[model samples]
Target: MSIITTERLCKYFKGKKALDNLNLEIPKGIIFGYLGPNGAGKTTTIRVLLNLAKPTGGTAYILGEDIRKSRNYLRKVGFLPDVPNFYNFFTAREFLSFIADITDIENPKKRIEETLELVGLRNEKSRIGTYSRGMKQRLGLAQALLSDPELLILDEPTSSLDPQGRKEVLDLIYSLKSTKTVFFSTHILSDVERICDRIGILKEGRLLLEDSIENIKKRYWKRRILIEVDDLEKFLERIKESLKPNSVEVKNSSVVIEVLDIQYTLKEIPKIVVQDGLLLEKLEILEPSLEDIFLEVTSGA
Candidate 1:
């Protein structure tokens, strides 16, 4: 069953459509990536799903229950916003204990200790003010997990962190895939590529594509063949007339050809090169990266 579902979900602000006719189904136990550029209505969608902002049109459901109907479902959901605030005066343990109490968690002390350990803050006795940005981010995650939520919705979780910090947080997020459904929304393409099982790309308030990472790669695979030859200009001219590939470009000491049919191109290109008596040093097909697909789809290029 889908852990989250939305149908024609929309939100507007001052005559601007933040979310437009969005339809999505996020299955349980998968790390789902919600990707888009800034102002692409990513945060707006999250707000609507949490009922923090009322949808101007359509509806959203969490765990098969409509968010507008009741807020009870929130108990089972954990959220880590892009920017999380904390009381600088409070220590890590103190802050977690406070959150536990507010949430009416049973045995708040034990839960706080467990959560501290889970986020690698077990030995932390310093006030939040003394914690590094990365530590604070981890603490934010610990607070979100305090209630043992089934669904964890994270917005730009690694936004401003250093490479080391980003790796640390991403590792923590990866560890949760076995136990929780993660809805990770970010513009970081590499992070999505690394951890997301499925992804949905949003552009100008609309969902342009949604599918498993593997499926997307296959579906949008660009058959680009890169050929390195002894004479770049000669090979470029020969292929332009003989091969008639979809597109051709001269790059430094090599020629790049984009073909519609990989099988045909692979068979035909070599034969043409051999016939021309030109030295073919290296030839390989180039796989399209997620960033390549994202730019093409979002920019409509």
Candidate 2:
């Protein structure tokens, strides 16, 4: 079942369209990366889903409930904004206790303790004002998860942290894949590749593409092959005749070939290598990064 679904959901500001007929469906138990460049109305989409702002055109459904008709879905959603606000004076435990009280969470004490520990903030005794940005972010996540919501909507959860901090948060997020449907919205390509199972690319408020990462790669795979061998010159000259590449170039010790048909080229390359008695070091397709595919779809180039 889809935890989040949108049907031509749109939003506008002034005379400009922030979102234009964006239809998206995020299935359950996957980390769905909502990818877009800056000023692509990512946050605007979140706001409307959360009922912070109303849609100008079409509507959305969260956890099978039409957002236009129901506010009940809000209770099952956990939100951690780009920059989470906290009471500066409250310590980690104190702050979470406050949140639990307001949300009326059952067995608040046990839940708070479990959440703090889960986010690695259990032993922290310093007030929120004394925490680093990474710590603060984790704390924000703790609060979000305190309710043990079925769906999580995170906005750029690791954009500002150092490498270690980012890793900590990412590992924590990846661990939750079995239990929660994560709508992780971000511009960070690498993080999405690292943790997301599927991605939805949005540009100018319109969803350009939405699919599993593996499927998208196949759909937009760049037709290029990378081959490294000890005998680069002989391998290159022989492979050209055998594979009939559209174009080929020698970069350092590897032959980068552009192929009209990648699968056919792949099979033919190995045959040529063995026939010529050339030692094959590495031979593989040059995989396209998410950023590459993102630009390809969004720019229409």
Best model per lDDT: 2
Model 1, range 177-255, lDDT digits (tens) per residue? Answer: 9999999999999999989999999987999999998999988887889999887777778777866889887788887
TM-score of each: 0.92, 0.93
- Candidate 1 lDDT score at position 296: 85
Q: Which parts of model 1 are misplaced by more than 4 Å?
A: 272-280
RMSD of 2: 1.9
Clashing pairs in 1: none
Screening candidate 2 with a backbone cut-off below 3 angstroms (N, C-alpha, C), the clashing residue pairs are none
Clash number by candidate, in order: 0, 0
Against the reference, the lDDT scores of all candidates come to 0.89, 0.91
Off by over 4 Å in 2: 230-234, 261-264, 274-279
> What is the Å distance of residue 223 in model 2 from its true position?
4.4
